[model samples]
Each structure stands twice: as structure tokens, then as C-alpha cells.
Target: MSRKRGKSGRRAAPRRSQASTRRSPVGANAAPAGRAANRSRILLMIVGAAVLLTGAVAYRVFAGTSPATSSSATLLASTAGQAQGETVDGISCQTSEQVVYHIHAELMVFVAGESRVIPEGIGIVGCFYWLHSHTRDGIIHIESPVDRIYSLGNYFDIWKQPLSTTQVGPATGAVNAYVNGVRFSGDPRSIPLTPHAIIQLNVSSEVPAHTFTFPPGL
Candidate 1:
């Protein structure tokens, strides 16, 4: 068929279809859209990886099972010296000299109107010091070649636990140390480990224990 012509006798150009118009621009712009989508996917992957790593770290910390922590605990325990149902540090408490002096002391703890049992192993570790405890009965045995002043804090240090004016283990609050049936008005840590000394560390109890009877032969 003959093409239509304008009045100047030139043929008119073919008009573009709606589908072609839509597709041409979309195709031209496709590269940027694809690049944006890829960037978004990479960002999402990075975020997910970071979240997973953080959660793993948090779990390890919460569980107290981190390698560093475990290794440190093992090192400390080994250093503290534990063997044959006994724990002691590198320091040697045993001496070839005869026991020139011997003394006994008692320890008692009260928490919230309840008697807390002191464990048997105070001063047994890191070289049972010149002073030691054999039983939970709170009898601290000061057996040494020479008599020397020792403090309740010294014993606790060998035991490796927190004992201060404000706290004892899980118990928190004011603490009082009584010696020989009298309330000691100084730092509980400073209570002297005198012979036949009756030391009572009371937590949250203002009134000290009246008496701590020593066992026979203590």
C-alpha cells in the first residue's frame, strides 16, 4: 500500500507503540536497579553474620564457658595446689622444727539469724599457714615453731573467698567480728588470731554470739 504523505510530499515517520515506549526506558534503567538489589542482599548478609557472631559471644559469656575464662580458672586452680583431697599453694607450711608453740581459735558465722557453717578447709591451701583449720567446727589451730600474730583476714585469704566489712560471699550488708565473747569494734579483717580466740563473723546481725564452746582438745 502507498504510505501517507504530508502536504510537502514527504512520508511521515512511523509512531512508536505504547509497549515499546515502556520497555525501552525500563531496559535502559535495569542495570542500576539490579546493582541496588545486589547491594541490599550483600548488606543483609553482612548484618546477619554480625548478629550471629554477637549472639555466640554472648552465649559463651553468659554460660561462663569461654576458652579464656576456662583456661584462667584451670591455671589458678592448678597454681592454688590441689592434691590428695587437699589444696595448698606453693608455699610450704611444714617445717622440720618441733612445734614450739600451739594455740587454738574458733570461728562462727551468722547470716540472717541463721548459723552458717564455716568449711573445714580454711588455711589448708597454698601451704597450710602457721595457722590452719582441720574441721568445720571452727577451730583454727595455730601450730608454729614461733608464736606470731595472725588475723582472720589472713585465714580468709588462704581460703580464697571474699570477706570484708560490707560483704561475705553471697551475703551482703554490715558485718561484725566478735572476739572472745566481745564485739570487736574494728575491721573484721583485723581481728587477731589469738590463742583460744573466739572469732565470730556475723553478717547482718548486730548482736554477736554469746559463746562458742571449743571442742575437747581443740
Candidate 2:
């Protein structure tokens, strides 16, 4: 009877060992699953970072507010005060901006394939000119007391900058002009500043014209 009890005890010990061996695979499999989950999370983080970077670049290009544009704005604004309260090309500066015949036009200038900013306060100092700019996004506000034909040359005269086939602002090269996405054959200075006109000037290198959507009530 004693021998039989000892043999039963040895048999129970082997059963416990078998149960422990079966649980070992569960722990081994769980380690691999945990590692896979961590890798997936890392991959998702990398992809998300790439997407955010791409979005920022697209917004900068579309809004035309890159670093270069800001620098150009500052440079142009520095000299804009020189023609304050002066009559330029029959356009007079008034104590306040007139909007009786209010209109807006957009001008885009590219030099060597780079876009330049048309600064704000083009005809403003202590007063406002009929042809003036209120922003640095290349918008020219035509706020006149009387309705009449206004030309791009008139605006440039107010800006006190040179505009010709061989010159634009300070850039000198063969000038190419576009009006409302159409190639303009006349002298670039003669391009009319019609209501909602989209004018583009490229110096040296030619660039395809781009259209701008005016803000509401512009």
C-alpha cells in the first residue's frame, strides 16, 4: 500500500509539469503579437508626419504667403511713402479713400521664375490715392470719385515704379504680359486696369498665367 501511494504522487507531479509546458506557448505567442502592434503604431506615426508636412507646403504655395513673399512686401512698403498726397497720372490723393466707383484688379509679377509681392499702402500715407493698395496680396483697389478708364500705367505711376517692355519695377528683361490668361500683344504699360482684371508680367522666363479668386465684396 505504501509503494502504490508513492507511485501515485510521482504521476501527479508529471501532470503539473505537462500543464506548465502547455502554457509556455501562450506566453511566447503573446510576445510576438505585442511586438507587431508596436511596429504598426510606429508606422502610422511616420505616415502622419509626412502628410502634415505636405499639407503645409501646399497651403504656402496656394496662399502666396511664403517667406520670399513676405520679404518682398517689406521691401516694397519701405518706398511706398515717397508719393504721398501727390497727383499721379491725373489720379489724386484724397483725405479719405473713395469708393463711389470702387473696383479691384490683381497684378502678378514674376522675375526669373519667382513671384514678387505687391505691397500694401501703395498710395497711402497721411491720405489715400484713387489708385491704391490695401493689402500685400497684389490687389490694386481702384476707388475713384468718377467712373473712367484706368490703365496699369496709371497705377505704376502712383507706385512710382517703371513699367515697360524692357523694364518692370526694378527688374530689367524682356517682359511678357498676360491679361485674364490671354497673351497681351500691346505694350505692357498700356494694359488696362479693368474691373477684376488679372494681369501678369513675367521677366526673362515665361510662366503660365494664374487666376485669382477675389474675396467676397472685393
Report the number of the highest-lDDT candidate. Answer: 2
Which ten residues in a row are the worst by lDDT in model 2?
A: 65-74
- Any runs in candidate 1 off by more than 4 Å, and if so which? 1-92, 95-98, 125-127
Candidate 2: Cα lDDT at 45: 100
Model 2's alpha-carbon lDDT is: 0.80
| Candidates' RMSD to native | 17.6, 8.4
Q: Please, what is the TM-score per model?
A: 0.53, 0.67
**Angstrom error at residue 15, model 2:** 69
What does candidate 2's lDDT look like per residue over 107-178, in tens digits? 888888778778778888788989888777788899999998799998888888888999888888999999
Full-model lDDT, candidate 1: 0.63
Model 1: how far residue 176 lies from native, Å: 1.7
lDDT of 1 at 51: 100
